[model samples]
Target: MGVWLVLAGLNGAMAIGFAAWGSHGVEGEAARWVGLGSQFQLLHAVALLALARFCAKRRRLFRPAAGLMVVGVALFSGSLYLKALGISLPIPMVTPLGGISLMASWLLLALAGWLACDHARV
Candidate 1:
Protein backbone atom coordinates (compact mmCIF):
# COMPACT_ATOMS: atom_id res chain seq x y z
CA MET A 1 0.00 0.00 0.00
CA GLY A 2 2.68 2.42 1.02
CA VAL A 3 4.82 1.34 -1.94
CA TRP A 4 1.98 1.94 -4.32
CA LEU A 5 1.41 5.37 -2.86
CA VAL A 6 5.06 6.26 -3.29
CA LEU A 7 5.25 5.03 -6.88
CA ALA A 8 1.98 6.72 -7.66
CA GLY A 9 3.38 9.92 -6.24
CA LEU A 10 6.56 9.50 -8.27
CA ASN A 11 4.56 8.90 -11.41
CA GLY A 12 2.64 12.08 -10.81
CA ALA A 13 5.91 13.94 -10.54
CA MET A 14 7.38 12.32 -13.67
CA ALA A 15 4.20 12.89 -15.60
CA ILE A 16 4.38 16.53 -14.73
CA GLY A 17 8.07 16.66 -15.50
CA PHE A 18 7.57 15.16 -18.91
CA ALA A 19 4.63 17.41 -19.66
CA ALA A 20 6.72 20.39 -18.67
CA TRP A 21 10.53 20.12 -18.82
CA GLY A 22 10.61 16.98 -20.92
CA SER A 23 9.77 18.82 -24.09
CA HIS A 24 13.40 19.40 -24.98
CA GLY A 25 14.79 16.66 -22.79
CA VAL A 26 12.76 13.87 -24.26
CA GLU A 27 13.66 13.34 -27.85
CA GLY A 28 14.50 10.55 -30.25
CA GLU A 29 14.40 7.03 -28.87
CA ALA A 30 14.72 8.05 -25.26
CA ALA A 31 11.87 10.52 -25.55
CA ARG A 32 9.39 8.06 -26.91
CA TRP A 33 10.47 5.50 -24.34
CA VAL A 34 10.05 7.96 -21.48
CA GLY A 35 6.68 9.14 -22.75
CA LEU A 36 5.33 5.64 -23.12
CA GLY A 37 6.92 4.44 -19.89
CA SER A 38 5.48 7.32 -17.94
CA GLN A 39 2.01 6.59 -19.27
CA PHE A 40 2.38 2.90 -18.40
CA GLN A 41 3.54 3.74 -14.87
CA LEU A 42 0.63 6.07 -14.39
CA LEU A 43 -1.82 3.43 -15.51
CA HIS A 44 -0.13 0.80 -13.37
CA ALA A 45 -0.37 3.08 -10.36
CA VAL A 46 -4.11 3.39 -10.84
CA ALA A 47 -4.54 -0.33 -11.31
CA LEU A 48 -2.42 -1.10 -8.26
CA LEU A 49 -4.50 1.18 -6.08
CA ALA A 50 -7.69 -0.45 -7.28
CA LEU A 51 -6.23 -3.90 -6.74
CA ALA A 52 -5.23 -2.97 -3.22
CA ARG A 53 -8.86 -2.23 -2.45
CA PHE A 54 -9.93 -5.55 -3.83
CA CYS A 55 -7.27 -7.38 -1.82
CA ALA A 56 -8.15 -5.61 1.42
CA LYS A 57 -9.92 -8.58 3.00
CA ARG A 58 -7.51 -11.12 1.53
CA ARG A 59 -4.11 -10.53 3.00
CA ARG A 60 -2.68 -13.81 1.79
CA LEU A 61 -3.85 -13.04 -1.70
CA PHE A 62 -2.61 -9.49 -1.43
CA ARG A 63 0.89 -10.56 -0.53
CA PRO A 64 1.73 -12.42 -3.72
CA ALA A 65 -0.28 -10.12 -5.94
CA ALA A 66 1.37 -7.06 -4.50
CA GLY A 67 4.80 -8.62 -4.79
CA LEU A 68 4.21 -9.43 -8.42
CA MET A 69 2.96 -5.93 -9.07
CA VAL A 70 6.09 -4.46 -7.57
CA VAL A 71 8.33 -6.77 -9.53
CA GLY A 72 6.47 -6.07 -12.71
CA VAL A 73 6.63 -2.35 -12.20
CA ALA A 74 10.33 -2.51 -11.50
CA LEU A 75 11.01 -4.58 -14.58
CA PHE A 76 8.58 -3.27 -17.14
CA SER A 77 8.32 0.40 -16.17
CA GLY A 78 11.81 0.58 -14.76
CA SER A 79 13.38 -0.61 -17.99
CA LEU A 80 11.62 1.96 -20.09
CA TYR A 81 12.58 4.72 -17.73
CA LEU A 82 16.25 3.85 -17.90
CA LYS A 83 16.14 3.39 -21.63
CA ALA A 84 14.39 6.69 -22.04
CA LEU A 85 16.70 8.53 -19.71
CA GLY A 86 19.61 7.32 -21.84
CA ILE A 87 21.18 5.98 -18.72
CA SER A 88 24.40 4.09 -19.14
CA LEU A 89 23.62 0.81 -17.56
CA PRO A 90 24.23 -2.76 -18.77
CA ILE A 91 21.13 -2.59 -20.93
CA PRO A 92 19.21 -4.51 -18.33
CA MET A 93 16.65 -7.20 -19.07
CA VAL A 94 14.06 -5.46 -16.96
CA THR A 95 11.16 -5.40 -19.41
CA PRO A 96 10.77 -9.15 -19.75
CA LEU A 97 11.01 -9.65 -16.02
CA GLY A 98 8.35 -7.04 -15.55
CA GLY A 99 6.11 -8.71 -18.10
CA ILE A 100 6.42 -12.02 -16.35
CA SER A 101 5.73 -10.34 -13.04
CA LEU A 102 2.62 -8.71 -14.44
CA MET A 103 1.33 -11.98 -15.80
CA ALA A 104 1.96 -13.62 -12.46
CA SER A 105 0.24 -10.77 -10.72
CA TRP A 106 -2.89 -11.15 -12.82
CA LEU A 107 -2.94 -14.91 -12.36
CA LEU A 108 -2.32 -14.60 -8.65
CA LEU A 109 -5.15 -12.14 -8.33
CA ALA A 110 -7.50 -14.68 -9.81
CA LEU A 111 -6.14 -17.41 -7.60
CA ALA A 112 -6.41 -15.16 -4.59
CA GLY A 113 -10.05 -14.48 -5.30
CA TRP A 114 -10.72 -18.19 -5.59
CA LEU A 115 -8.83 -18.92 -2.39
CA ALA A 116 -10.67 -16.22 -0.57
CA CYS A 117 -13.98 -17.64 -1.65
CA ASP A 118 -12.89 -21.15 -0.75
CA HIS A 119 -11.79 -20.08 2.68
CA ALA A 120 -15.13 -18.42 3.21
CA ARG A 121 -16.74 -21.85 3.10
CA VAL A 122 -14.11 -23.61 5.20
Candidate 2:
Protein backbone atom coordinates (compact mmCIF):
# COMPACT_ATOMS: atom_id res chain seq x y z
CA MET A 1 0.00 0.00 0.00
CA GLY A 2 2.71 2.40 0.95
CA VAL A 3 4.64 1.53 -2.17
CA TRP A 4 1.56 2.09 -4.29
CA LEU A 5 1.04 5.51 -2.78
CA VAL A 6 4.61 6.46 -3.48
CA LEU A 7 4.38 5.25 -7.05
CA ALA A 8 1.10 7.10 -7.50
CA GLY A 9 2.69 10.29 -6.29
CA LEU A 10 5.69 9.94 -8.52
CA ASN A 11 3.60 9.03 -11.55
CA GLY A 12 1.21 11.90 -10.95
CA ALA A 13 4.07 14.35 -10.68
CA MET A 14 5.71 13.04 -13.81
CA ALA A 15 2.43 13.25 -15.67
CA ILE A 16 1.99 16.87 -14.74
CA GLY A 17 5.54 17.72 -15.68
CA PHE A 18 5.29 15.89 -18.97
CA ALA A 19 2.01 17.54 -19.79
CA ALA A 20 3.54 20.94 -19.29
CA TRP A 21 6.52 20.03 -21.40
CA GLY A 22 4.31 18.67 -24.14
CA SER A 23 2.19 21.78 -24.31
CA HIS A 24 5.09 24.19 -24.34
CA GLY A 25 8.17 22.49 -25.70
CA VAL A 26 6.95 19.63 -27.87
CA GLU A 27 5.09 19.80 -31.18
CA GLY A 28 3.56 17.70 -33.96
CA GLU A 29 3.43 13.93 -33.58
CA ALA A 30 5.88 13.98 -30.71
CA ALA A 31 3.60 16.20 -28.70
CA ARG A 32 0.73 13.85 -29.40
CA TRP A 33 2.67 10.88 -28.12
CA VAL A 34 3.81 12.76 -25.05
CA GLY A 35 0.27 13.84 -24.30
CA LEU A 36 -0.97 10.28 -24.67
CA GLY A 37 1.74 8.95 -22.39
CA SER A 38 1.04 11.61 -19.79
CA GLN A 39 -2.66 10.81 -19.87
CA PHE A 40 -2.04 7.10 -19.36
CA GLN A 41 0.42 7.73 -16.55
CA LEU A 42 -1.98 10.05 -14.76
CA LEU A 43 -4.92 7.68 -15.13
CA HIS A 44 -2.97 4.65 -13.92
CA ALA A 45 -1.63 6.64 -10.99
CA VAL A 46 -5.18 7.25 -9.86
CA ALA A 47 -6.02 3.62 -10.56
CA LEU A 48 -3.19 2.61 -8.26
CA LEU A 49 -4.79 4.57 -5.45
CA ALA A 50 -8.12 2.83 -6.00
CA LEU A 51 -6.38 -0.51 -6.20
CA ALA A 52 -4.76 0.14 -2.84
CA ARG A 53 -8.19 0.60 -1.29
CA PHE A 54 -9.53 -2.52 -2.95
CA CYS A 55 -6.51 -4.51 -1.83
CA ALA A 56 -7.43 -4.01 1.81
CA LYS A 57 -10.38 -6.32 1.24
CA ARG A 58 -9.30 -8.41 -1.76
CA ARG A 59 -5.57 -8.73 -1.55
CA ARG A 60 -5.41 -11.79 -3.77
CA LEU A 61 -6.93 -10.25 -6.87
CA PHE A 62 -6.08 -6.61 -6.32
CA ARG A 63 -2.42 -7.28 -5.65
CA PRO A 64 -1.90 -8.88 -9.04
CA ALA A 65 -4.03 -6.18 -10.64
CA ALA A 66 -1.76 -3.55 -9.18
CA GLY A 67 1.30 -5.36 -10.40
CA LEU A 68 -0.11 -5.60 -13.92
CA MET A 69 -1.01 -1.92 -13.93
CA VAL A 70 2.51 -1.02 -12.93
CA VAL A 71 3.98 -3.12 -15.67
CA GLY A 72 1.51 -1.76 -18.21
CA VAL A 73 2.29 1.81 -17.37
CA ALA A 74 5.99 1.13 -17.52
CA LEU A 75 5.92 -0.48 -20.94
CA PHE A 76 3.14 1.49 -22.64
CA SER A 77 3.85 4.92 -21.31
CA GLY A 78 7.57 4.37 -21.18
CA SER A 79 7.70 3.46 -24.84
CA LEU A 80 5.67 6.50 -25.79
CA TYR A 81 7.90 8.74 -23.74
CA LEU A 82 10.97 7.36 -25.39
CA LYS A 83 9.40 7.81 -28.78
CA ALA A 84 8.51 11.38 -27.95
CA LEU A 85 12.18 11.95 -27.24
CA GLY A 86 12.99 10.63 -30.72
CA ILE A 87 14.43 7.41 -29.40
CA SER A 88 13.59 4.22 -31.23
CA LEU A 89 14.16 0.80 -29.78
CA PRO A 90 14.88 -2.46 -31.51
CA ILE A 91 11.99 -4.07 -29.65
CA PRO A 92 8.90 -3.30 -31.66
CA MET A 93 6.46 -5.38 -29.62
CA VAL A 94 6.88 -3.54 -26.35
CA THR A 95 4.01 -1.11 -26.80
CA PRO A 96 1.54 -3.81 -27.78
CA LEU A 97 2.57 -5.95 -24.85
CA GLY A 98 1.96 -3.01 -22.56
CA GLY A 99 -1.49 -2.46 -24.03
CA ILE A 100 -2.34 -6.11 -23.43
CA SER A 101 -1.10 -5.85 -19.86
CA LEU A 102 -3.20 -2.76 -19.26
CA MET A 103 -6.27 -4.51 -20.59
CA ALA A 104 -5.55 -7.55 -18.42
CA SER A 105 -5.19 -5.35 -15.36
CA TRP A 106 -8.62 -3.88 -15.94
CA LEU A 107 -10.07 -7.33 -16.33
CA LEU A 108 -8.48 -8.45 -13.08
CA LEU A 109 -9.84 -5.40 -11.31
CA ALA A 110 -13.30 -6.16 -12.59
CA LEU A 111 -12.93 -9.77 -11.47
CA ALA A 112 -11.87 -8.63 -8.05
CA GLY A 113 -14.96 -6.50 -7.74
CA TRP A 114 -17.19 -9.31 -8.91
CA LEU A 115 -15.66 -11.76 -6.47
CA ALA A 116 -16.06 -9.29 -3.64
CA CYS A 117 -19.71 -8.83 -4.50
CA ASP A 118 -20.21 -12.56 -4.64
CA HIS A 119 -18.51 -12.98 -1.28
CA ALA A 120 -20.72 -10.31 0.26
CA ARG A 121 -23.80 -12.12 -0.95
CA VAL A 122 -22.59 -15.25 0.82
Candidate 3:
Protein backbone atom coordinates (compact mmCIF):
# COMPACT_ATOMS: atom_id res chain seq x y z
CA MET A 1 0.00 0.00 0.00
CA GLY A 2 2.66 2.43 1.09
CA VAL A 3 4.83 1.36 -1.81
CA TRP A 4 2.11 2.05 -4.33
CA LEU A 5 1.35 5.43 -2.84
CA VAL A 6 5.00 6.41 -2.87
CA LEU A 7 5.43 5.30 -6.46
CA ALA A 8 2.35 7.20 -7.55
CA GLY A 9 3.53 10.40 -5.94
CA LEU A 10 6.99 10.09 -7.38
CA ASN A 11 5.71 9.38 -10.87
CA GLY A 12 3.37 12.34 -10.71
CA ALA A 13 6.17 14.66 -9.73
CA MET A 14 8.51 13.32 -12.36
CA ALA A 15 5.88 13.67 -15.05
CA ILE A 16 5.26 17.28 -14.19
CA GLY A 17 8.94 18.03 -14.12
CA PHE A 18 9.46 16.47 -17.50
CA ALA A 19 6.46 18.28 -18.91
CA ALA A 20 7.81 21.58 -17.75
CA TRP A 21 11.10 20.85 -19.36
CA GLY A 22 9.39 19.86 -22.55
CA SER A 23 7.32 23.02 -22.71
CA HIS A 24 9.96 25.58 -21.90
CA GLY A 25 13.44 24.12 -21.68
CA VAL A 26 13.66 22.14 -24.87
CA GLU A 27 12.61 22.12 -28.51
CA GLY A 28 12.16 19.93 -31.56
CA GLU A 29 12.71 16.19 -31.11
CA ALA A 30 13.64 16.44 -27.48
CA ALA A 31 10.42 18.24 -26.70
CA ARG A 32 8.44 15.56 -28.52
CA TRP A 33 10.02 12.81 -26.47
CA VAL A 34 9.44 14.65 -23.20
CA GLY A 35 5.89 15.46 -24.19
CA LEU A 36 5.02 11.86 -25.01
CA GLY A 37 6.82 10.46 -21.99
CA SER A 38 5.29 12.91 -19.57
CA GLN A 39 1.82 12.34 -20.91
CA PHE A 40 1.98 8.57 -20.41
CA GLN A 41 3.76 8.95 -17.10
CA LEU A 42 1.16 11.31 -15.73
CA LEU A 43 -1.71 9.17 -16.92
CA HIS A 44 -0.24 6.10 -15.29
CA ALA A 45 0.63 8.05 -12.18
CA VAL A 46 -3.03 8.84 -11.68
CA ALA A 47 -3.95 5.27 -12.48
CA LEU A 48 -1.52 4.07 -9.88
CA LEU A 49 -3.19 6.25 -7.30
CA ALA A 50 -6.52 4.66 -8.13
CA LEU A 51 -4.90 1.24 -8.05
CA ALA A 52 -3.52 2.02 -4.61
CA ARG A 53 -7.00 2.69 -3.36
CA PHE A 54 -8.30 -0.51 -4.92
CA CYS A 55 -5.45 -2.44 -3.36
CA ALA A 56 -6.75 -1.64 0.08
CA LYS A 57 -9.74 -3.84 -0.71
CA ARG A 58 -8.33 -6.31 -3.23
CA ARG A 59 -4.65 -6.53 -2.54
CA ARG A 60 -4.24 -10.02 -3.88
CA LEU A 61 -5.75 -9.31 -7.24
CA PHE A 62 -4.60 -5.79 -8.00
CA ARG A 63 -1.02 -6.00 -6.75
CA PRO A 64 0.30 -7.60 -9.90
CA ALA A 65 -1.45 -5.05 -12.07
CA ALA A 66 0.12 -2.25 -10.11
CA GLY A 67 3.54 -3.82 -10.31
CA LEU A 68 3.29 -4.16 -14.07
CA MET A 69 2.19 -0.57 -14.39
CA VAL A 70 5.26 0.52 -12.53
CA VAL A 71 7.52 -1.49 -14.75
CA GLY A 72 5.78 -0.25 -17.89
CA VAL A 73 6.14 3.36 -16.89
CA ALA A 74 9.75 2.94 -15.89
CA LEU A 75 10.70 1.28 -19.12
CA PHE A 76 8.55 3.28 -21.53
CA SER A 77 8.85 6.68 -19.97
CA GLY A 78 12.41 6.08 -18.86
CA SER A 79 13.46 5.23 -22.39
CA LEU A 80 11.73 8.29 -23.80
CA TYR A 81 13.36 10.49 -21.22
CA LEU A 82 16.72 9.12 -22.17
CA LYS A 83 16.01 9.66 -25.84
CA ALA A 84 15.01 13.24 -25.10
CA LEU A 85 18.37 13.86 -23.52
CA GLY A 86 20.17 12.44 -26.59
CA ILE A 87 21.04 9.22 -24.84
CA SER A 88 20.21 5.97 -26.50
CA LEU A 89 20.34 2.61 -24.88
CA PRO A 90 21.97 -0.22 -26.76
CA ILE A 91 18.69 -2.05 -26.49
CA PRO A 92 16.43 -0.67 -29.20
CA MET A 93 13.41 -2.67 -28.17
CA VAL A 94 13.02 -1.19 -24.71
CA THR A 95 10.36 1.33 -25.70
CA PRO A 96 8.25 -1.29 -27.44
CA LEU A 97 8.69 -3.64 -24.52
CA GLY A 98 7.47 -0.92 -22.25
CA GLY A 99 4.41 -0.36 -24.38
CA ILE A 100 3.71 -4.07 -24.33
CA SER A 101 4.12 -4.14 -20.59
CA LEU A 102 1.69 -1.30 -20.21
CA MET A 103 -0.85 -3.11 -22.36
CA ALA A 104 -0.36 -6.25 -20.30
CA SER A 105 -0.86 -4.31 -17.11
CA TRP A 106 -4.21 -3.03 -18.32
CA LEU A 107 -5.23 -6.52 -19.29
CA LEU A 108 -4.23 -7.80 -15.89
CA LEU A 109 -6.21 -5.02 -14.31
CA ALA A 110 -9.28 -6.07 -16.27
CA LEU A 111 -8.76 -9.67 -15.24
CA ALA A 112 -8.43 -8.66 -11.64
CA GLY A 113 -11.67 -6.75 -11.85
CA TRP A 114 -13.43 -9.75 -13.36
CA LEU A 115 -12.09 -12.07 -10.70
CA ALA A 116 -12.96 -9.72 -7.91
CA CYS A 117 -16.47 -9.33 -9.19
CA ASP A 118 -16.81 -13.07 -9.54
CA HIS A 119 -15.67 -13.59 -6.01
CA ALA A 120 -18.07 -10.95 -4.77
CA ARG A 121 -20.97 -12.77 -6.36
CA VAL A 122 -19.95 -16.09 -4.86
Candidate 4:
Protein backbone atom coordinates (compact mmCIF):
# COMPACT_ATOMS: atom_id res chain seq x y z
CA MET A 1 0.00 0.00 0.00
CA GLY A 2 2.74 2.39 0.92
CA VAL A 3 4.63 1.58 -2.24
CA TRP A 4 1.57 2.03 -4.38
CA LEU A 5 0.82 5.36 -2.78
CA VAL A 6 4.36 6.52 -3.31
CA LEU A 7 4.39 5.37 -6.91
CA ALA A 8 1.07 7.05 -7.57
CA GLY A 9 2.26 10.33 -6.10
CA LEU A 10 5.64 10.16 -7.81
CA ASN A 11 4.25 9.27 -11.20
CA GLY A 12 1.65 11.99 -10.89
CA ALA A 13 4.32 14.53 -10.15
CA MET A 14 6.50 13.34 -13.01
CA ALA A 15 3.58 13.55 -15.39
CA ILE A 16 2.81 17.10 -14.32
CA GLY A 17 6.41 18.14 -14.77
CA PHE A 18 6.68 16.55 -18.20
CA ALA A 19 3.42 18.09 -19.29
CA ALA A 20 4.56 21.48 -18.13
CA TRP A 21 7.85 21.16 -20.00
CA GLY A 22 6.08 19.99 -23.08
CA SER A 23 3.65 22.81 -23.03
CA HIS A 24 6.04 25.60 -22.05
CA GLY A 25 9.67 24.58 -22.32
CA VAL A 26 9.94 22.51 -25.45
CA GLU A 27 8.93 23.06 -29.04
CA GLY A 28 8.22 20.96 -32.16
CA GLU A 29 8.28 17.14 -31.97
CA ALA A 30 9.77 17.23 -28.53
CA ALA A 31 6.61 18.84 -27.33
CA ARG A 32 4.58 15.99 -28.72
CA TRP A 33 6.71 13.43 -26.92
CA VAL A 34 6.43 15.30 -23.66
CA GLY A 35 2.71 15.56 -24.16
CA LEU A 36 2.30 11.83 -24.67
CA GLY A 37 4.66 11.05 -21.83
CA SER A 38 2.64 13.31 -19.56
CA GLN A 39 -0.58 11.62 -20.54
CA PHE A 40 0.77 8.12 -19.84
CA GLN A 41 2.26 9.29 -16.57
CA LEU A 42 -1.13 10.54 -15.48
CA LEU A 43 -2.74 7.26 -16.42
CA HIS A 44 -0.09 5.28 -14.61
CA ALA A 45 -0.53 7.43 -11.52
CA VAL A 46 -4.28 6.86 -11.52
CA ALA A 47 -3.95 3.12 -11.99
CA LEU A 48 -1.51 2.81 -9.13
CA LEU A 49 -3.83 4.75 -6.85
CA ALA A 50 -6.75 2.57 -7.81
CA LEU A 51 -4.82 -0.59 -7.08
CA ALA A 52 -3.78 0.73 -3.68
CA ARG A 53 -7.36 1.51 -2.72
CA PHE A 54 -9.36 -1.24 -4.41
CA CYS A 55 -7.05 -4.15 -5.10
CA ALA A 56 -4.47 -4.21 -2.35
CA LYS A 57 -5.77 -7.55 -1.14
CA ARG A 58 -4.90 -9.15 -4.44
CA ARG A 59 -1.27 -8.41 -3.96
CA ARG A 60 -0.08 -10.98 -6.41
CA LEU A 61 -1.36 -9.24 -9.52
CA PHE A 62 -1.94 -5.76 -8.18
CA ARG A 63 1.74 -5.14 -7.66
CA PRO A 64 2.67 -6.29 -11.11
CA ALA A 65 0.09 -3.99 -12.63
CA ALA A 66 1.71 -1.07 -10.94
CA GLY A 67 5.08 -2.08 -12.29
CA LEU A 68 3.67 -2.63 -15.73
CA MET A 69 2.07 0.79 -15.71
CA VAL A 70 5.40 2.30 -14.87
CA VAL A 71 7.15 0.29 -17.53
CA GLY A 72 4.51 1.04 -20.11
CA VAL A 73 4.83 4.70 -19.36
CA ALA A 74 8.53 4.44 -19.88
CA LEU A 75 8.26 2.45 -23.06
CA PHE A 76 5.39 4.25 -24.70
CA SER A 77 6.36 7.70 -23.58
CA GLY A 78 10.05 7.03 -23.79
CA SER A 79 9.75 6.07 -27.42
CA LEU A 80 7.92 9.22 -28.30
CA TYR A 81 10.45 11.29 -26.44
CA LEU A 82 13.31 9.66 -28.33
CA LYS A 83 11.55 10.09 -31.63
CA ALA A 84 10.87 13.73 -30.87
CA LEU A 85 14.58 14.20 -30.37
CA GLY A 86 15.03 13.08 -34.00
CA ILE A 87 16.92 10.01 -32.92
CA SER A 88 15.73 6.79 -34.46
CA LEU A 89 15.19 4.08 -31.92
CA PRO A 90 13.79 0.60 -32.29
CA ILE A 91 11.88 1.03 -29.05
CA PRO A 92 8.79 2.81 -30.35
CA MET A 93 7.52 -0.49 -31.67
CA VAL A 94 7.53 -1.77 -28.13
CA THR A 95 4.74 0.65 -27.38
CA PRO A 96 2.22 -1.94 -28.54
CA LEU A 97 3.56 -4.44 -26.04
CA GLY A 98 3.08 -1.88 -23.32
CA GLY A 99 -0.41 -1.26 -24.56
CA ILE A 100 -1.08 -4.97 -24.39
CA SER A 101 0.23 -5.07 -20.86
CA LEU A 102 -2.00 -2.17 -19.89
CA MET A 103 -4.98 -3.93 -21.39
CA ALA A 104 -4.17 -7.06 -19.44
CA SER A 105 -3.85 -5.08 -16.25
CA TRP A 106 -7.27 -3.53 -16.75
CA LEU A 107 -8.82 -6.87 -17.55
CA LEU A 108 -7.30 -8.43 -14.48
CA LEU A 109 -8.55 -5.54 -12.39
CA ALA A 110 -12.05 -5.95 -13.75
CA LEU A 111 -11.97 -9.62 -12.99
CA ALA A 112 -10.85 -8.97 -9.48
CA GLY A 113 -13.62 -6.46 -9.00
CA TRP A 114 -16.15 -8.91 -10.30
CA LEU A 115 -14.90 -11.59 -7.98
CA ALA A 116 -15.13 -9.22 -5.06
CA CYS A 117 -18.65 -8.26 -5.97
CA ASP A 118 -19.67 -11.86 -6.33
CA HIS A 119 -18.22 -12.70 -2.96
CA ALA A 120 -19.95 -9.75 -1.39
CA ARG A 121 -23.25 -10.97 -2.77
CA VAL A 122 -22.83 -14.35 -1.15
Task: Report the lDDT tens digits of candidate 1 across residue range 18-61.
Answer: 54434577777777777766666667667677776665555777
TM-score of each: 0.72, 0.92, 0.92, 0.79
Candidate 4: give the clashing pairs.
Answer: none
Tens-place lDDT digits, model 3, residues 48-95: 999999888866758888999999999999999999899989997999
Candidate 1 wrongly placed segments (more than 4 Å): 1-3, 15-24, 116-122
User: Which sections of candidate 4 miss by over 4 Å?
Assistant: 119-122
What lDDT does the true structure give each of the candidates? Answer: 0.70, 0.89, 0.92, 0.75
Evaluation by lDDT, superior candidate among 3 and 4: 3
Error of 3 at 4 (Å): 0.3
RMSD of each: 3.6, 1.9, 2.1, 2.6
* Candidate 4 or 2, higher lDDT: 2
> Model 3 TM-score?
0.92
RMSD of 4: 2.6
lDDT winner, 2 or 3:
3
lDDT per residue as tens, model 2, 1-122: 78878888888999899999889988999999999999999999999988888776756988899889999999998999899999997998898899899999999989977876857557
Inter-residue clash pairs, candidate 3: none
- Write one digit per residue (lDDT tens) for candidate 4, span 18-96: 8888899889878987898789879878888988875467556667666766677777776666666677875447767
Candidate achieving higher TM-score, 2 or 4: 2
